[model samples]
Target: MTIDRPRSALMAVLLAALPAGCTPVATVGPSRPPLAVRGSTATVEIAPVLLAARDHFPDGAEVRNGGIPNLVGAAPVEGLGGGGAADVATHAETQALRYSVAHPDIRIILTVTEGLYRIVARRSAGIASVADLKGKRIAAIPTTSSGYFLARMLASQGLGLDDVEVVRVSPIETMAKELADRKVDAVAIWEPHADNALRALGTDAIELSGTSIYRERFNLNSTAAALADPARRARIVRFVRAVLAATAAIERDPRPAQALVAATGGFTADEVGRSWPHLAFPATLPGDLVDLLVDEEAWLAAQEKRPARERGELAKLIDSSVLEEALAPPR
Candidate 1:
């Protein structure tokens, strides 16, 4: 995919402005076959990874590809797999667990990506904070991914969904068009989308600001369901190890990741590369962020569009032990 020039320059400036030595780029290497034993069973969101796994493990390995744009589709996939949905959306793990209550066998395995949140409004609009969004029509999707982030921003200024007119747009690219046409007054989107969207409007046309709101309140992740049989869980954990390894490879060298995501029709290398500076390439879950899921769960529960949920019940749904052990060196 073609890279956006103006946006690229802007990102360059912002990346430079970041605290010294905070480069988010990970050095990636050439793709190869699965390092772990083949024939493992696990579900993943990114289709490219599944395809790559097939290339890497062209043997008896069986991978269940079950990525949905929203958290809703992940539930059924998780149920069938005997685990809850491993959410691809930010802050979605807890919400997926709430879905697992009825389907007790399901659990969540998260593949976390790093990204930064930018609150954008038309340039010269002088909109410096979330408080300025009051009554403005903003474009975005409400997902487990962005739920907590947006809520925290709004709550930081005593605002809620009611404070602004939320225009439902599927992806950030689409939202960019609406914002460019003035159909929406503002938008909250992560990198790549934020970068791509800003390019459509011309860098000067949009004012950008970053906040801890997302890291402070939002969590983006992928999950695999938990299995009842300990042995099966063990297998799933092994799969998790492979997944983490792949993620690390991507983080180390995003070129492959950029290529993979582009091939999957998600975003381009330019977009991913631009987003790279703003995103985290961590190999582990943020416990603090995970702990904050309770608040996010509570907020989602209040929304009519969201599934019902119980307080503090989200913690039980996350089974990271497999991931923990998998990351440990082989005995």
Candidate 2:
């Protein structure tokens, strides 16, 4: 939770560089309950974008920030109800699928964004492509989406985790630092950290695009109890609507949204601007979400030596009714 000095200084500089009339800090609207919303500190997921678009939220809907290092364990999901958090956002679709499998009480209500993850390497490391990763030290945040990205990237070239030296890093900031310091040959990560690594290494950075191997889907997940409760469901619907509106706002004019992300994420405006094109802010759930989950589940089961889930069983993990209703014409 502690912001490092270098990051703190970068945030300060970025904030000061904003246009004269821009707000210095990201804000959220008032709340009815401490709506526990979990988001990662490194990715520009829906929750942070909503926080950045504070004015688009429903009146009196307060959002409590529950930013975490990553969404690998059940702790963040359990915190939605057990830890007094109402909603959580996950950067990886696989995590949401995993949560639904582990906790039958949780449902993936909405998918807010999608993007292409990348593997950044030093050009001098001879890692020009995924095929070059064998025996090389690759830094990644374990148990998060980055891990999945690494796996897929390797698998694309007939490789696996065993094909490379997996160097575990956390909180994302270290991933960038390690790659820049030459402590690792490559980093499999998501933005804005991936973007940060590229900037840090500059001419030395070589990005291995995973567009062919991986595409990320970030979702808003909630406990069954929250979905079952009328008041909480209504609030969640409103939250989704606000996120949809915020997505439209960003599409229309991204400067304010980028500024807010830079301020809150400890990223420079240039970094956000450079990374923006890779992200797609969509409010609705994808029609092929179940297929994607099934594919990921198969990949995971194979990798972990676990039982693969049936299509019918995996289909239950997604509940698009909320999204459908939210996007419906007002009665």
Candidate 3:
């Protein structure tokens, strides 16, 4: 699928914004060839960072975007078809907090590195927490990670699927319509979709708040594929740098950044502007969270979802050195 932002515009805006300090010409060291990195949305939140890195490095660090969801599992667009490089993929934040005992080959990257936010359809009145949804009808699809987040949200309330009715729906647009029609009480979604949900339901119909389980339920993780490959790891580190840099730029002056985000998809500058304060464009992977992910893999193993071979070796699954290097002070 085509990216939301056109190549010409993205290049122009990012290039024009390149500060003197960020200019490649300023670097005195001998230049190296740009790295070639390919993967799913494992490191997507850092897109702007990667773009800036490409400009400064000028060695052609190419990041090919495809189905980010597929990086954790099969591509979402592929439709229930599981059997690809990413079928084993998982969301970074969520996987980082859970146990995935049976998948040693599973690797997680700090892609979209932010916590989960519950964005309800506009009609829900004064709904501020998961507790408000005690007996409400929520809409979402189980196949997606967003659905998993919703599940975790409910779990925090001492409730499960049995507690409330779940409607099988995919797009947040559909969920918003249903909520508008009084079909569902609320909708749980991630970025871009969260923006869409807000617009469709309007403030009158929806609500937004942090989830009950902050660090444990909703967090980041990546694929084992990135850890095992040296070339991929180095490239990922560079990509992380790019994202952090872009985030700093975006936060410092949002007009162009919002423009970039909108050009990529359905989000509006107003929505992105409002949501900016809530996003955590972190480049470091905390150690305890890594431990949580190991436990999550173990949990998955106990549930018989993970492959048997990966059960006891979850600790070796993470390689945070790349994140550490990215967070290091620039020379």
Candidate 4:
């Protein structure tokens, strides 16, 4: 898929550990399929990648609406699939576990952005701190990163997920409304939905974030076959470089990027503005990505009732050379 450009909170995540990286462009080859890409149009996390595809891309790639699931067909279409048209895709690391094992060709080349999730609780629900979430109804999508974040957050407070009722929220766009209507007392999710919940609650809102526990690594992914081909690799590198440049533009002034996201994701300007700080456009591979994956595998493994993989196997899923070439010194 063609890439797109791609958060904030009360505690604010420490993404300084996620470094700024660069890359240069290459000309696309004349080929079949037009080199389409798949990613989530509804997610603000992928705005930069979307922008890159629209504004950059020498040969221009199709920015299909899907995610990592689109890159590989191992998982169901629930996540927005990559299929045959998806030469590239963007998704969080958790999704990688499900499809990466079955499809060994998949690899994460760059972390386009980071999702600093937060728990937006209704202060009226007798919750004002992370510790107060016990026995409360918390909305988080199960079998995904959001649920993992909920578990991690609760563990920090000496509580387990069993201590509270985990309410399932669908359409994800409804997460804010679910909490605001008191159907769920809290929501641990990605922005701008998390920020939407906070604003909905207003005086009743209590936001608790900032944890070393977990920050979703939303990355750019491609198959080994695509990268191994000279023509396709050249096109991929150019797309990656475009993504990095788009991120730089985002970090400088998010207004234009916000407008794009608001229009694409159907988010209001205030929602985009409020949630902007929650995201970090590192665009570089985070040093601890594999470590994060290893730590997270067990949770996903348990969810799917499968054995977790070793660190080495997970490491193979990330290929840094593309970003390195992109970040290489200009000759």
Candidate 5:
């Protein structure tokens, strides 16, 4: 039976109200949305999830373009199959609170930080350290991991975005060139692009040291209703397992993962190799996940012009059961 528009709205309302671990009755066939993972082809971050879908996942999974916003917004928003949102999506933790405000049920299930995120700056710009970034123009994608990273890095050295000219460059992949051409002094960005910046500037390019300052907690997210649905949840778990397996494979022998990313033609083999090491695959959820969220919430809330939610409130966004089960030993 086709679900009428009225029933569909009602179902959405009902699903939104359900607890994070609860779901309506199981339904199959065309009415149910096909299980799909969503992410961006633009960044090197999505490679592990891509590998999982391509090799390890039992279901025929394919990654579509988009991120947390598309995942949290009801379908018709992102055009995921069967008029539903992506069951699982990949993005940085920075995206969580912004989207979760409307869809409080969004849960971060896995830490997808296959590597470290960074800031590429020009040595000619007198940028020897993170502190020197003050008063210089830096390009960053707003409300993204890269943006949040800029904030954290600056704050670490008693600087804020106010202290620097934060430039938002179009076709963010061009950020590297921007720095090399001196259009911007520095850029806080994810891999491949960060690698591109280094390549664009070569000896003139300096990656500011901030291993202790910040790292992108790129993650896999799903809705409460999806997690609550047994079948959907199982598929999601399987995909997480696949992601972990893929991470292990990438860790053991990155050439395969590098080839996979190269196969997409987004980045050259060298770009992937240089940037790939910057990422460390810790398949498990980080213990600092909630701590990071609580700290980042203030910045996100201020940026959105809203009051930050309580710490406990932010804590609800993580659902570790999926990771736990994914790592659990066979019975």
Candidate 6:
């Protein structure tokens, strides 16, 4: 049975879950209005690999594009089909899950990507480890997964956001430039951006890979309304299959995938190539997904002074049936 939470109730729950000293991060506004669905063609927010996979979809499945961040920010507002390539721990996904608590109109269905999230510090800054970030300026896009990864890495090193001066950068493309210009001592970011920063700084860059702290999961989240529609559901299933096939193709020969992502993502071929090794594409939810959510929830709760939710409550955020169906063998 699904629980339908009212928006106010959801906010209260989130507020109560905040850990002491954690200020609520400002909510992200959508880039535009949510995409309107037309017939069997569903609109989705996607990034990188999934965007590349759309070209491979068989007939009968049509997906319109929505801006990746806007997809998550707009889902509760307009109820679009789903948003892909969002980290499970990011505020966007967490907000979507909270919105789902009362609405039941949306749910996270699949994990499309996983990778090592890292912190790249300039050796010239006299930084050698995560602990060196103390009193230093760290650049990050606070609303995204990179921010969450930064928080986790810092916590692991017995530090917190308060320990360093945070330099907020937008467009993310500018992060590498900011680091190279000596505007920020380090950048805590995901692939492509991290690679871009390292490349810009050349031998001056020092990557502090906190692989033990973060195994980031990027997901494909869908609206329950979309899943409830027979035709849209079928199309979604096909879309998932296409994505899986793309994953295999990329795994087998990443050169083609690299070119695809480089073209679409605005990165050079060399940057994508450097970033590709750290990325893994998997179609199903991770077995430890709920555990990760629980831990992250607790951490967020502590930081925000909100009450931590029970594991079972967090588990309800995922609807794995769609993925299971996609993976199931035909009779």
Estimate every model's Cα lDDT from 0 to 1. Answer: 0.50, 0.69, 0.50, 0.78, 0.75, 0.60
Error in Å for residue 145 of model 3 = 3.8
Model 6, C-alpha of 113: deviation from truth (Å): 0.6
Q: What is the per-residue lDDT of model 6 for residues 1-331, given as tens digits with 9 covering 90 to 100? A: 0011123443344434434522122122344221122110110112333333334453322223332333334442232224442211112344444444445455667777776778998999999988899989999865456677888888888998889888888756689999999999999977777888988999999999878887777666666666777766665665666567777776677665555344333345576677777776776788988888887777666655667779887887788888877777743
**314, model 2: CA deviation in Å?**
1.6
Candidate 2: the clashing residue pairs are: 30-62, 31-61, 31-62, 80-85
Model 1 C-alpha lDDT per residue in residues 1-331, reported as the tens digit of each score = 1111123444465445434533233222345222221110111124224323432222222323233323344333321222223323333353454455444333444545444677667764556567877778877666545555666777888999888877777634577787778888777765556666678778655544555555522222333432445654555555555556666666556555454344333344466567666655454656664455566666666774566565445666556666677788865
TM-score per model over all chains = 0.68, 0.84, 0.66, 0.87, 0.85, 0.74
Lowest lDDT 10-mer window, candidate 6?
A: 36-45
Q: Write the per-residue lDDT of candidate 3 for residues 111-193, one digit (tens) a residue.
A: 43454566475444446667777778777765445656666677777877678778876544466677767777777765545
Say which candidate scores most in TM-score: 4
Better of 2 and 6 by TM-score: 2
Model 2 lDDT per residue over 140-195, tens place:
85566778888888988899999899998754677888888899999888787788
- Ten-residue region with minimum lDDT total, candidate 2: 63-72
lDDT of 5 by residue, 80-155 (tens): 2233367888777887777898889999999987447678899999989988998999999876777888898999
State residue 91's C-alpha deviation in candidate 1, in Å. Answer: 8.2
- Candidate 6: count of backbone clashes, pairs at least 3 residues apart or interchain: 18
**lDDT (Cα) of model 2:** 0.69
> In model 1, where do residues sit more than 4 Å from their true spots?
1-65, 68-91, 94-98, 101-105, 124-126, 205-211, 216-226, 305-312
